[model samples]
Target: MHTFAPKSIASHWRLIAGLLPWLLTGCASAGYQMPDLSLDSLLGSDQAAARGQPVADIGVTRCDQLTTHEDDWDRVNGVPPVDGEDIDIAAAIPACEKALAEHPGHRRLQAELARAYAEAFRYDEAFRLSGQAAEAGSLYALIQQGHAYRYGRGTPKDIDKAVNAYQSAAKAGHIGAMNYLGSTLYQRDGWGDRSKAESWYRKSANTGNATGMANFAQLLLIDGKQEEAFPWFERAARQGNAFALQQIGTYYAVGGEPAIKAPYTALSYFEKAVEKGRPSASVKAAKLFIQEAGDTSSRLSESERQAKVLYWIEYGMPKLSTRQ
Candidate 1:
């Protein structure tokens, strides 16, 4: 992506230096090695950026166009698929079924159909199709199998089997699978290894996966390494990750070494995150408007400020209630 100017790069290094003590101390206490914080390491390669570039269409088949998951490593033409929850399940199920019928035994079509069926709550069909697709060497299908086992969809819930499915795909170089495996292990309570989870998250982040970057950054934040996590969150935010956008907004809201407190900038990011499906950010944005209105230095009239605050509260109220 976006190129950093020389001045901005220098500023970032200064911020990193200010936070180094916390990072080193945190890592030492946790018995984990410190991560490389150099700009080169964080920026990665041009290829990694290219990998995340989105294209308008894949033009493979109607089913492929409709049901390809956004996180699939094998996505052709850099086609950006809809998120699972955003997929038009009714349309996708029929479209994928028709496509599979037209091209019998196509593994990718099988996996795509499985995804649509899963969204439609046809768990048995989803599980069966995903199994067939996985046997036919579809890495994406393995993730579906993992989800089915993990959530007890059409079969008994089996965390071990879920891990196996995700691990297999991860070992085979599926970026999304690495993130999924890390998440599965991290949430497993007594059996979970935070170290293993971190490593898996790092692996996925190194591959330029947006979800991985966000997850890894979150883990770092939890470990009291906010300085180290900031850049990763920025990277994921640039890739349009909703969670990362919200996190960046939060960082801006609180003045720190890495982020200067800028209410306007924070509000901009919060609004962007809300547009990207992070409803909680709406509350943050609304609060900022109210804070700004009360600021003696702010130029906006009281009425204008009140209107902005009202707009955000009303817009966000419905979503906040539904968020867990």
Candidate 2:
């Protein structure tokens, strides 16, 4: 593991679909969409030993749920949990609350519910649920408490307290705690304490946290330490980290010493990344394909490059945007 900034790599959660995108929505109703795709096989499907049945169909309507008052679509804006994105605050909140009640005692479920409340700007409820969750003492639950305190979801702003909780969790073997703590320190922008930010990132990476490794690599690469960063990126990529794949693609595209900057190699990495189902990488790879192969008018070029962008936008973005 290496040291890097929190934002240096893509956010931890962004790797969900690629790392292991399984549904946690708990929507066991008649209309839920269940794509039967496994990310590992997704990229190699055409050449796969056998074509697996789709676990869920993205096109499923879930019609009644969409319009039902109980489904909570009213509050969601259809955006994802990615930072800098918007979500339907009001409807989503009630939906999550309803879910929590139905699946009580599931810490991940409660944490998500609390997070939804926090996302919707409902601090009181977020705090309440997070409190209950923290009492459960789950890693995700403790992280929720940290979220409540630092972001003032229910309590006043207190960086120190949030840091303490994160540190405690990090020490207690919560890998995500390392991410949270590292991110907080990195955001501090204490020029004199840049090392401190990197230190926390190392703690996170040492925890075998994929996000931490990705971020650490990102930090090193951005700082012109690609020599050191490549290993970290490889570490995360080995775990099916789409972001790391994209980074490797970039290295290949650029032709570094250890990594030959061959468009073919880059394409291989990008295509693999796209197959593993990283939307951004799909788009990036598509963009690169076009840039390298020229415009869509060429018959051969069009077939190869054009398909990349289509899937990236059509199938990729929607799935990513709708994900929690």
Candidate 3:
């Protein structure tokens, strides 16, 4: 799984943590009314596919006495070890703890449990478990440890330690680590080198990491190489990256290249991204709606345009504000 910044609500845990407060406050000063739907329903049913179903939903009734030998244990775990964004942190603790007790040395399980701990905001336990998993040779654990150190989650914020952890994991062939390391180097400001960052991103992309592809394309775009960047962005979007999806939609809407520009196609992509929990897509959708309405050649009416803008403002503002 790709690790997003703390400010971003892309991860299930971050979304839940951030949204819970705003959901209660109502932000009345902003003149925004809370929706009638439960906070859980705010994300909608598509979250199952977006986040992955949880262990309980996968028919594993007992988190205790878990089968560590199962092949599924080696795969990446969604929150609470299944495909949903709404994680019950309190409930997940015991099951994950019991599994670790039984399997004592299972690296993947340790890493997954570390992620569970991290999501629950139990950073000390998350860091400890990540270390244990890393010692057991789990590359995923190494990445988790890097994140913990990077943001000072459980320990001091040490960029050097974070870089070391990511380098170790990337060298061991962890794609997520590779991409993250690239990003860290890219965003390190004065100490960061774009050329170095771009190389690492390319290396990650070569390994078929979708996030890496998106990152590389973004760098290309920064260099004004839109024609070269287009295919890479499309590739990442096909891999279900919401950022890439929105970027491709923006490209299509703006007509950078005559061959690919199409407002309807752009609208479809923006809608797809919005369903995937991307707040920017809502604003983009609003802009495109108004733009299409204003086109003298289009059949859309003024009323429809206002309705679309109003809908997105009502819908997107809450999410965008929470992220900010």
Candidate 4:
């Protein structure tokens, strides 16, 4: 083996200079975190199932084990659910089909297969199956129908229809549906109703919905009610909501009525948000490392600080496009 020469200081500086533009671009765009309209948010967890409400048997089939969304209301004991993006659509579609074939006329299986189809972008199949399940009184299926109409997956985009479906499910006391209704009303281009959105969010939050708590808290933060928002953010964070974790990090980074300035603690929360799939936190974490490096009173040596910065840049660069 041949001995290798270490990189020169100039080379290191040159590398950092090359990376600076990418880092700054990510940081600049990080200010506007888009509202989450992800699959998990759309197909939220089933509070009724968690409360021991009677639901169709979902654990008996291999399809259920493979395609069950992590937030799905019904889960089989000992079998973990996967995130929406984590679903293997090709495999899930076939598995669900086989299960439905075995248990003919099973509305729940239809809904599950519909979800798999939706994930695969086979919106026509998703719409058909979800419609069938909705007719059979599956609130989750109704929500899926709303999503299809709202986004025009396989049907014409109809906000009124979407709102109607969400309202029907919300009337049935679906916490996720309430949150969806709030999001829809709050973000509906020119006709958004802030008062109605706030009302729905408050309803969901009162029912202990983590997403609702986070959404309501965001509105409070926007209105400069940091002290009031902090508790709600903390509540959501305790339930492992990534957005709430990031918000808490922001509060900690800047001294405020409820949150004291704590850079190290803030950095930890940012890292946690990254772990929870909030890529925007990566830039925040990197910036904090750079700030710590520049502070002469900090305990880290110059070389150590440089290494940390490099590590963060490399770690966060690939994730910048997945900002949430």
Best by lDDT: 1
Runs of candidate 4 with Cα error greater than 4 angstroms are 1-59, 294-304, 318-324
- Per-residue lDDT of model 3, residues 45-110, tens digit only: 442122212222232323422322111223533423343234445666677787668767566667
Local distance difference test values of all predictions, in order: 0.70, 0.55, 0.62, 0.68
Q: In model 1, how many backbone clashes occur?
A: 0
Better-scoring candidate (TM-score), 1 or 4: 4
TM-score of 2: 0.60
Which residue ranges in model 3 land beyond 4 Å of their true spot?
A: 1-73, 76-85, 258-261, 294-305, 320-324
TM-score, each model?
0.75, 0.60, 0.70, 0.77
Candidate 1 lDDT for residue 16: 8
Ranking by TM-score, best first? 4, 1, 3, 2
Per-residue CA lDDT of model 2 for 256-313, tens digit only, reads 5657656766766776677666767776666676677643224465565566567665
Write model 1 residue lDDT over 109-216, tens digit each, in one string: 888998888877889999999887766656677788889989999778987678667766665566777889889878854433577678889987876678889999
Clashes of each: 0, 14, 6, 0
Model 3 is weakest, by summed lDDT over 10 consecutive residues, at 13-22
